[model samples]
Every structure is written in structure tokens, then in C-alpha cells.
Target: FVSMACSSSSFPLMVSISGVRGIACRSITPELIVKYVAAFAYLQITRHQKDLPITEKPEIVLLRDSRVSGEWIERISAGVLQSMGANVLSCGIQPTPTAQLLALQRSNAVGALVITSSHNPKEWNGLKFIDSDGLFLSPESCDVLFQMVNNSAYQYPSFEQRGSFVDFADAAQIHIDTCTSLSYIDLEATKKRNFKVVLDSVNGAGGPIMKSLLETLGCKVIGLNLEPTGVFAHTPEPVPENLGQLCSAVVEHSADFGIAVDPDVDRCVLIDETGKPLGEEYTLALAVKFYLSATEKRGPICKNLSSSRVCDDIAKEYNCISYNTPVGEIHVAKKMVELNAIIGGEGNGGVMLPDVHIGRDALVAATLIVQLLSGFEGTISEYKKSLPQYQIVKLKAPIGNMVPELILADMKKKWEGKEGVTLTEGDGLRIDTSDYWVHMRKSNTEPIIRVIGEHQSEEEARKVCEQFMSEIQNWKAETSE
Candidate 1:
């Protein structure tokens, strides 16, 4: 919700509902890490002790991604938790979802902290706090934690009362086992197909577990950037432009398809057999279709305002209603639980299955993709072609001195009471027309305004985005004048 734009010379730290992120050694120093961790631990300890016996110390699951500073961050984070009289269950170099699942499974665990920048460049590092229910902190909880940080409201326990630390090495395998054990997976049938997959982990935390999961499901893996070095092979967003290498490799190896995951392995993208990237929006659409077709249990579907409308189309086909919340995985996940949604996720290749735990998980997404492909007679691209098609264009504009709220307020006024245009406000401004929709919101992870437009065709989507981008710029100009 913070609108201050991020720049190297200006404020480099980004703390929002998503978590805290900044350039390593610059804005995210050891002191900053300790302060945040201590505050989080204190919050968890006080919040949970009331529900439990007095003798029990709150347990926290701590993990990290493949950033170069992850190790030291983990050490400092663990030390802070221990000093605050909270036991630390350290799972070194595991995906963010894995840590969330572990936290949910541990009955004594009150929360978790993941040291990851999650698809950011290697120079960035941060923390993602997960509550006992295995979801990110809600907005209200985040406000309380930030207040605690600002007030310096943390206390350390005596030396004898400090908590213990233990290493948990089986977290990745546990996540794989959970994914394969799902009844809908049909691992044996998928294994019979003997899929040839080209996996690109970009040398992040997902490399080992993703490869292991594919092979366990009887895939012939052609690994790229499999090592968990902090250095990435390319930009780590897993977008189309950043995945040229994976596309070429899939064609060169003549593989069935290629799979790409972000650094934390929460988002999953695919390259078809023809060496073409399926836009990230399709990851959720395909997963929803597959789940609906494969199961008899029907429920509502939830997605973010910025996600493609194809999900609504699919939901209607199955006689299920679809709901849209503000942008953020936690928002979607909470809505899913409220609606008992069978499946929900974001548009950025994040798929959340409540059965597998309420978090965006690449392992679950990849497993669904493999199982869905195994039953089909054609290639990946063909399967994508058969689904409801829509073009989604995502663009960002810098929010210079102008306030995002004022701009969004103006947009609401401009589009309000139009023929078929409906405006949705709260997180940002979303204008839904008869043919298309455009959502403008402040980025939770970065310092800019994210403009997402979707329509039946690429041209129309781009046009809508450009029109709105021009309008926003003009507003800034008028304000300056």
C-alpha cells in the first residue's frame, strides 16, 4: 500500500504486505534483519502463548532461498528467534512453499520466516513471514508487526531460557511426497507416459526438488541451471522474454515440454513442445480446467483483480462462480478458504490448491501440468489452444511525486456510471467494461504502479493498456503544472 517509488539513490527498502525486500548489504543489513526478526518472534510468542500451556516455547520454521546472503541471513534470523525464547526449525535452501507446508504440519510451530527475494535479481534479498495457518500475514497483522518494529518493542530472554535450534534436511522431499500422494495426481499413469521435460530453475532454490519431483514421477529430465548457486543464468522472473534459453533448449532436445520456476519456486511457467512459452496466465487456467474436469466436487473459484478473465469463463463452464480479490496470494487464499474454493491462484503462474496447503506452489502446479498432459493425446501447445483464450498485457509506470490514490480516484470518477463500465476500488482502481478490463494498482513488491489489461485479442489488450498509461501520465503532468 506504500506508494513511495523505489530507486537506488532514494529509499531502497520495500516493506509491504508481501514482505520486506531490499538490496543486500545496502538496505538489508544485519541490524535490519535482526530488528525485523526479533519483532516477528515477539509477536508470534505473545500471540500464541495465550492459547497454549505456559511451559511451551513457540516454534518457528526458518528457511532460505539460493541467494548468496541467504546463509548469513538464516544464521542471524535463527539467533534472533533463539534469543527471544523461540525454537528455530531451520530448513536450509528450501522453496518458500515448502517452509509454509512445514510450518502448517508442525503442531507446535507458531509461524515461519523465509529468507528470499523470490524472483528478484540476485542482488536483492528479503523476508516473507507466514502465519501458523501457513498463509502470509494479513494486512491487519502486518500493521501490528510494523508498529512493533517502529516502537522497538522486543525483549530478549535470559541465557538459560533461550530456545534451541535444529536442522531439518528432509523438507524438500516431504513437499515432493505430499504432491505425489495427492489422489488426483495419478503418478503411475503419468509415469507410464515417460515425459521428457526440460526444467530451468535458474540455479535457485527450486533446482534440486523440481528435478527430483519430475524424475520421481518417471520423467526424463533435461536439466538447465540445476545447481543451487546464488548466481542466476538470466533474469529470474520466468517471463517470456527471460525464457529464450529454455525455449531453445526444449526444441534442441526435442523434449515433451519445458518448465520454468522463479527463485522461490512459487510460480510455474511452461514452454510447449513447439518451443513456445505459454503465457503465465494460462498456468492457473489450465490447472482449473484440469481440476474441474478430473473431479466431481465443484466449488467457487477465486483470483486476483489483475488476473485474466479466462478463469471466470472456465468457472462458468463448470457451473461455478468466480470471485476476484485484491492482488496478493494471501488475499486469494483467504477468499478461497471462505468460499471453500477447490482451486485458486494469481495470474503470475501461481496455483494454490487447498488440498496441498493454501499457498502458491510450483511443485503442485508442475505436478498438475504433468498429470494433465499425460492423459491428453496431443502436445502441450495443443492443449493450451483448446482452453479459453485471452490476451493479458502487464505494464508498469513510475509513480513520481504524484499520489496513486488521487489518480485512481480520478479514474473511478471518469469511468463511473458508464454504459457497461463498473469500477472496483479498495486495493486500487479496476474498470471492467463489456469487452475488457483494466486494473491499476500499486505494486506490493516494488515501487511502481502496475497496469494490467486483458481482452480477447493482443491488440485490444495493448491498446487499453496504452490508453490508461497515457491518462495516468497526463494526470501527473497536470498536477505538476
Candidate 2:
């Protein structure tokens, strides 16, 4: 019912402490990057001083995806941090997770800046901040830092106190080695299968590293868009519809499967052996299946509330407990740490293994999934059929004029007492039934409300979503009058 439905042309540059994303020189400019980076550096130095060594300024790591605009953002960011008397460890183009891992490697690192717009288009670029512990800043951290930026309370040191810059080139190798070294991965079994995989990197930062990773896993790798040229061949996001080339390449080569990574390489999507594009939601589900099968000790699993319920089903198969957090990588990762979870990530093709690294690593997800396929007796399609089947339908409407609380109240009044249905809210309104579920909430990154439904069939999921859409429209019309 909300009428301000923004199209791609009208979508605002998403800005937050997590990152500031926009088309270069439009919503995001060099000056804005400088101010934001300076503010972030200010907070890192002030709040994270507990781990500071004596007689030195705090160090921050800087890296970027393969976007053309990222080069300028990285240079501007490094300059701002340097101006603030903070040392910068400049890592050239790399995955967002690589930057996080490199930050953890440095004993004196206070934080890191990753210049990327993630899955956004070529013109979009932004800065993602990572804390000393190699995790994205929590919402609470973002709130505090945004306040400082808005108030212009950031610290700027004089010329005598400027910080120095150092280049670190071993980040990609380190990330690769660490993933292959995880105890949960079965290298011998994976190698024995000698799987042939088609990899689509979308001409982003993932190209070289993903090829290296696939080869290391002993698979015959067919590369598409392998160059880190920053010129996107298709939409940068690894969604099913955008991955026609990957699916076709898999069929043409008769590869065992196809793999795709987002621009930053933090998220991964897969295509089955049948040249079918598997939904991004299945990435974590498949990972969870492999992880629980590999280890006898099933501790805890974690995911965002909006993620597919297949994760919970997989955890149950291993007699493990699964926890849900709000829809954010930080929320899921933080909860995983707090609960000592074995693995956790969002449904958008991100898989976070605390054993390998705290952040989402597409490389790690691909490794585990290969291990799973290598050990299984059937094709990826057969393996997918073995799991509980569910189809999800997702739609978004603008958050115009209506208060979210009032809308949620109306929903509760309408459905709370329905037979065999239950309602709960942590990040949004979710109604769970015996065979179907629906979740409606505001998007964290965009100015819209998303309604997602999961049912046994596509038709069923669509029906549920359409039902809600009609109700919301009716409610909006009434409120306007």
C-alpha cells in the first residue's frame, strides 16, 4: 500500500555506518568519503585504545573490491586516515572477508575499511568498516559512530602527527590457505572426486582467488569473467535470473556444478549439475548439511530470522540447535560468537565459519559444498531433492506515510488468532504455520518493506504473498481516507 516504490533509477545511495554506497560523484563524493572515513578513524582510535601498544598510533587496514570507482574511494579513505594520524595497511583489491581476516592478523589493528558496493552495479562504490576483532561494526557501534560523524566530533591530527601507509599483498593467499586448512573440509575425498566446476566471478574481486580455490580443491575449473576488470558483464548480483551464462556454461562443459560470487566475494550462489540455478538461500542450507554430516559434535547453528527455515530443518537432522538473529551479517555473526556456534550466515549466499574466519567467505562456502558433493552418492540435483522442499516468494513495497507499528498491529489483529498459526516478531512480523510461513518487515538497507512467504509450492507461496499484498493495500486506502 505504501506508494513510494522506488525503482533502480530512484533508489537512494544506501548510507550507514556499515557502509556508504552510491554512484560516484552523485550521492557519494570524495569529500563525503573523507569525512566518513575520518569519523570512523576517530572512533576506532578513541574507543579501541584498550588494545593499543605504547608509543604508536592505531593501525587500520584498507582494501577494496574490483569496482573502478573503488580505487578513488580507497585513496581518499587512506588519505583521511593518514591525516588523522592512523597508520593504514593498504591491501589492494580483495574480498571483503580478506580485509577482515587481514585486520585480525595484525595484532595492533584497530579497524579496517573495505571499499565496495558489494553486489551493486559498476558505478556504485562504498566503504565497509571492520572492527579490531575482524567483524563488521554492530548496530550499536554504527549508532555511536554516526552520532560523532553528524556532530563533526571526529579527531584530526596536525601535520606532525600524520600516520604512515604500508602495503600488504599476501591477503589473498592467506585467505585461501586458511580455508583449505579447516579441519571440517575433506581434501582427499574432494580431490578423489575430481569435480569439474564452472565459476562465474561477474568480473569482480572474486575471479583469480575463486579459480585458485577451485583448483586447490582438485577440481577442473572453467572460468567466466575471470579478470578483475571491474567492467561487469551482467548485473553484478549473483541472483538466479542474472546467472544464465553460468548455468549454460555448466551444461556446455558438462561440469559437475557452477559457482557464482558477488562483487565483493563475501556471498556465493550455485548452479546444480543439471544446469539449474540454485537459489542463494540454498547455499547456507547445503553448507549446514555438509557441516553437520562432517562432525559428530553438533553444537549450535545461527542465521538471520529472514533466512530460509531449511537451516533449522538441517540442524534438527543433526540433533543440533539453531538460533535466529535480526537480518544482518553482524547480527548473525555476533550471535554465532556469543553462542559458540559452529557455523552461521545470512541466506544471501554468505556462509560464516568461525573456525576459518568470523566473516562470510564465499571461498569457504564453496569448499564445504564441494566436500558435501564429493561424499554424496548422487548429483547436486539429487542431493537437493533429499532435503525438505520449500519455495519462497518475496515482494517489496515502499514505507510511505504509514507507521510500521500500526501496520503490524493490523496484521496481528487479522491473523494472530487464525487456526494453527502463530505470530512472533524480533526484526519484523513473522507468521508460522504447519506448512507455510510469511515474514514482513522494513529493509535495513533500503526504504521499503519486504514481504516474504515460504510454502511447499511456488503457487502456495505466491498465494500467501498476494493475500498480504491485498490486505496491506486495503489498509493503506482506509488510512488515507
Candidate 3:
């Protein structure tokens, strides 16, 4: 019998197409980073070898957020890729989506690696892999790559065959230029507004890029945590509760609105002119309104099942169709690709525009929101009030030792015949009714089951969430007993 101790059991490491995430130096050590980065490069070389030209060397773009551990991870990644005979294009401390966009521009690029943990705590840092097409890897690709990592199947070239490195520091400029040149962005109109705006990047990757983009649009910027020092001003998620400083700053500066991005700058949340957060969900909702209104081609809009139904409402208003997949930005992105969705994203401030890269882009979201505001007659608060109002209550409970399958089955039986109730079980259990919907899913990044309920009224949403929370608590207690 063999007994092996695991030192990282307490700090769980998560591996998915999104990337590997865990506590730095614990589950996500330098050694692990090198292994995974090598695995990624190997998979790309192996899978895409036939498509490559013999004379062209496979190139990869590497980027990182402002997390303190990012530089060390970047060094390990660069070493692994170079050792494996791939050319590296290093775009230091850029937004997650910027890495993806830059990948598409490289003719010989096979993939890109972004070192970021998004909204995770300061202690956590990770990587997100972008394919040559500038999209996150699909589940099938991820599965194959994981097998390679497990088997330690990676190539190490001879000294003479080692790859070369190039400093590609202009990713931020490329992103801004691309966003500004998009037909939807009213550059002249945005500039004429001369809008005063406050930006809080949480000392992550978004600060410089967002400031540059907003300034180009002629907004007077009052920036907070503009330095990408990795020392976060507060909790880094950009949720309403975590954005009190931004809210206060918005009012203090008399800015038109305040924008906040998570550590990696993919998700964007907004604070209104009146010092009220528009909620992360509104970021996508308003962008949908703008994008759909501007585009002539009417197509289906894609969103995750757990995303706000406001997306559906907007699509319906445009006389377009709306479709949903399971949770995760990749799911939404893939669905958008399949359906050729003109606009879509998750409720957590992710805006996926096929016109810009397929990944969730906070920069794109901010640009689109400003375009929407440019044509509007009132403040963001008033504009928000014009839309359909839905209250979403989110809660999480520890999974403990309970079997999620049994709990889901029980939930299905209990709500099976109830009028106006519908059940879904793919990504955990989701119960939908005419006016309210509740989705309970085991979090991919955390050890808890997230319960979310949305209704037209705050009271009803709260009630629905509480009911489900209580049920889960009861079931967990019974299982432990």
C-alpha cells in the first residue's frame, strides 16, 4: 500500500479551459506553472502541426495581470515555451482580453497564455489560455491538454532550437485603436460629451488601458489605483458592495459615471452619475441595448442560463431570438459562435462581441456603454430606470459531504408538477417559473454550491433564494447526521 501526502489539499487548484487557479506557491507553484505552460504549447504544436507552414515558427503571446506573483509565473511560462522551441511575444501586464486580441493578429501565433486569476483574492494568481483564433480553449481541447499534462508529455528543444522572445508592449494601444475604430463607437459624439469619468481598476491590468481609451474618447478621467502594482485597493471583484470607494469617488469628482474592472480587467461594473452601482448585470444589458440598436443584422443573443433574463428581454425588444447555455464565459462564447450571436455575455459584467474577439472584454463593454450613453438624453440612473427591472439574490452554501445528485433529484421531484415550474439539471439544478427563476450550481472555482434567484421584485427574489438556501442547509445537515 502506498500513501502520499498532499500539501495543497487545503488550497485547491482548479484546472479548466479558463486556466489553472489556486493559491500562489501552494497549489500553483512555479514548477506547476512550467508544466502546464509546456503542456499547453505541446498541445497546440501537436494539434495544429498540419496547418502550419514549415518555414514559420509557432509563436505564442504571453501576458499577465498586476498580481504580485505574475512576474514569477511569467518567467516560468517564458522559460517553458522557449525551451519547447516556440517564439514568445510578451505583452507585460495587459488585460485578459487584450492577450486574446493580440493573438489573432500574429500570423504564426499558435496560442496565448494570460497570467491572471480575474477576481480571485490577492494571494491567488493563474493563467487563461487563448487559442490562435483568439478565443478561450473549448472543453474538448482542454480535456486533451490535461491528458498531456498528466502524462508529462512535453517537448524540450536543443539549445540551438530554443525559441526567441519579442517584447509586444503595445497590446493596450492595439486594443484601444481596435475599439475606437469599431463602427458602433461614436468617437466624435463621445468626445463632444466631454464626460468626466472615474475609473477604479483595483490596481490590476485595466488602469492604463482604460485611462487611455477614456482619454481618447475625450473624457476627463479621475483615476483610482491607476498604477498596476497588484496591491488591490479593496476586494477586487467590482461588485456593488466592494465598490464603495468608486461610488464615493464618482460623486466626489462629479463624474458622469464610474467604471470598475476586476484584477484581470475582463469583467466591468459601473457606478451611475448618482453614486449608485448599475450592477454588474447592467453592464451587459446596456451594451446589448446599444449593440442591438446599432446593428442591421438581427441574430440570436447568447447568454448563460444563470445570467439575467434582461438579456432575453432586450433581444425580444429587438425582435431577435435569445438562447442560453450552462455557466461559464466559454459556454456563452461557443454558443455565440454556433448561433452567430451578434451580442452576448454573462451577467457578471462579461460582454462578448464577435466583432471584437470572442472572449469577454471589459474594454469593449466600456466602449459600447459610452456609445450608448452618448446618444441618450439622461443620466445612467435614468437610463437604467427605463429598462425592465429584475432583482437577483445570490447565495452560496458549503457542499460538505452531501451528494449534489441526490439533492437535485429531490428538488426535481418536489417541483416537478408545480404549475409554471420548469426544471433543468445540466449544470447543477435550475428551477424556472413564469416570473422567478432559481439556479443552484456547484461552483467550478469554489467549494460551494451557488444559489441564485431572480424576480421582478426584490422581495420575491429574496424569498426564493432564502427558500432554496434553507432547503440546501437542511439536506446538508441530514447528510452529515
**Top candidate (TM-score):** 1
**Tens digits of lDDT, candidate 1, 311-355:** 998999999999999998888988998999899999999999988
lDDT of each residue in 1-481, candidate 2, tens digit only: 1112222455466655346677777767887787789899999988876677677678999988999888878888889999988899898988999988877878878999999989878887877889888999887788777677768888788899899999988888999898898887878888999999999999999999999988889999999998998999999988877999999999999999999999899999999988997788899999988888887767999987778888989898888999888777888888988999999998889999887778888998999999899888899988999997788888878767666668887898878788999887867788999988888877766566888888889899999999987777777788889
- The best-first sequence of candidates by lDDT reads 1, 3, 2
- Per-prediction CA RMSD (Å): 1.5, 2.9, 2.9
The parts of candidate 2 lying over 4 Å away from their true place are 1-11, 398-405, 473-481
Instruction: Report the lDDT of model 1 for residue 292.
Output: 93
Reference-based TM-score of each model: 0.97, 0.94, 0.97
Q: Is candidate 2 or 3 superior in lDDT?
A: 3
Q: Tens digits of per-residue lDDT for model 3 on 155-253?
A: 776798789999987788999999999977779999998889999999999999999999988889999998999989898988888999999999998
TM-score of 2: 0.94
Q: Ten residues in a row with the worst lDDT in model 2?
A: 1-10
Which candidate model has the greater lDDT, 1 or 2?
Answer: 1
lDDT of each: 0.91, 0.85, 0.86
Estimate candidate 3's RMSD in Å.
2.9
